[model samples]
Target: MPDGTVPQSVLEIRRDLAAAYRLIALEGMDDGIYTHISARLPDGPNGEKRFLLNPFGLRFDEVTAANLVTVDETGAVIDDPYGAGVNAAGFTIHSAVHMARHDAVCVLHTHTVAGVAVSSVKEGILPLNQWSAQFFDRIAFHDYEGIALNLEERERIVADLGNRFVMMLRNHGTLVLGRSVAEAFKLAINLERSCKAQVAALGMGLTPVVLSDDVAEHTARQYQSAYDAMELGNQSDPEWAALLRRLDAVAPDYLG
Candidate 1:
């Protein structure tokens, strides 16, 4: 039996993970329950590592805190109150990052049209806007090896993502990692916006102005400084809070 403290922490993680799934759906970043957003649980049976994932076959909007499944490192469904199994592809992609990147408490992946469009291109996300500038030289790219169902591919995926917070899955989609759910969701939203802006610029049949390397680096530094300032205050991010309020109004059941 688990201690009293473990269940509360698990519930909080579940609520955050479910909120991430719903927020992704709200932003149109979901791919029909295909993509996943996973968060590490604080404790598990026998102190083993575990994470929370959306139950397979549920649309992002349909995922509730109570329905998320608890899975072990090897993708086994250790505890699933809703009687849903885990998705093989989700396990394959997420486990690799969670295992390799201890700093990454949350891993959010998406398959939006713009994200996939950018991923399909050889150049990946360009430094076309402030949002894009933030990812300048910070994003990694992993070649798509068909569907991510084979466990062996996890090694290569981890290698490609080495210490980077954002990744472009070549010809596939986008993945963002962060030390917290707020950080991961923020990165994912910015990445998607960057990709959308790039696609729009390319669609205009004119070359987008890419910022100089120095300017891009400066902009990234500014963003990082702002993030550091925010963290120092120990306050919840206003943007993340706003999104949660939106969820409260439209999808309160995500906390159920």
Candidate 2:
């Protein structure tokens, strides 16, 4: 590969995915070493159905671009510089999305407190705010079926998340899919914020005002359009770059 070529693209994806893991930790959204964030490689030396995933047993803050492992669709390690394996549960959920959703280049899953709380509620992701409105009628819900250890659950999970970017795993956490790492991270951030706000409002013992259906629909469309436009751009998102800078200042080893 030349100077600004194949290896560069792979490195960029690794760095962005690693940055996402660190940012999740920085935002207090990580659940120790339980959750996972993965990015699909455009084309691997083996094939295109390869992805970069965080190695099991490493904390999010401990993840680095160089330490991330390359795995196939079946979660088999194709190239692991650290000789680390992926979490079985993580592979189940992420591989299902990466295989079922062709447009999903990145899959982010988290076990945040607020997200799990909201998922456990009957009325998941209430449209209490503009941010919450974006997920109104758009987010998918998959009933909890234990710890996602079975491969059969993948089909049902995909069916539940049909044509939607966000999915709340009942009694579990949240799952977000994106065409890029930036998009997936942004969605995860917003989804978590929405959950946090809803939880905070409910805890206050005050009945929150819900947005009208028409208003929520309009807002969701606007947000989706903006996201689509951002995806069409040639350069990486500035917000992603800024987040990378923040990581560089603190946990610079993420790109090691």
Candidate 3:
């Protein structure tokens, strides 16, 4: 039901999405063999939906552009993993999100230390400071229902995600979806930092000062533009470039 020439710009997206996986590993957001990141492939000439995602059993740090697996929305392999099939559980969950949210071009899911810790908290993420304040009124929580293996679970996940960029998978981990790999990576970084800050603040045994409603709104607005502002600096020091460098150092093969 979609028609348009597949843009050449998509090649850049593939490179960036691959870079994002490496960066996620460099940032300590990867969960060993778990968690997956995906980007929707532009529709083909025949109106088919295909997507690129990391292969099964591959560590995030080991992922590469050439090695990224391509698959249809129904969990069928379109391009061989440069080796084997992708994780069905991971692809199923990611594919559901892509099928339901057309605006979501890049999907990132993680089970990092701080994110999982916060997910277990009864109050979830709090607006205790600037970092957390940015997400004060923007987060959505999905009560955990095992390891996300069920295709049936996608309905509730989509319902809970709605239009928010961040979702706390209660008792499991955190999932961040975005229209671009950079946007999704940025959201994941902020959400994880916010959660880490919360855990650290609470560990100090001191009551934290919470942000006011107006300030929270203002901060969130600033963050919405933070990506652009950060890129205004010299290209050599651009945050995305810096992120890629970090990935190169930790997982050099990811750009392949």
Best by TM-score: 2
How much is the lDDT of residue 67 in candidate 2? 93
Extract clashing residue pairs from model 2.
Answer: none
Give a tens-digit lDDT track for model 2, residues 71-94: 888888888888768885678889
The lDDT of each candidate is: 0.84, 0.86, 0.80
How many Å off is the CA of 69 in candidate 1?
0.7
Quote model 2's TM-score.
0.93
Between 1 and 3, whose lDDT is larger? 1
Best by lDDT: 2
lDDT of 1 by residue, 1-256 (tens): 0111112266667777889999998888999968889998876558898988888899999999899898988778988888979895677779889988876778998888999999999999889889999999988999989988878998999998888889999999999986677778988999999999999998999867999999998999887666555444444578878888999999998888
Ranking by TM-score: 2, 1, 3
RMSD of each: 4.3, 4.0, 3.8
Question: Candidate 1 overall Cα lDDT vs. reference?
Answer: 0.84
The digit string of per-residue lDDT tens for model 3 on 1-256 reads: 0212123265677788889887887788998988889998778779989888888888877778888888899878888757778887787778888888886778899999899999998899988877888787788889999878878999999999888778899988998887667768888898999999999999999988878889888988787566434333222326667787776686677667
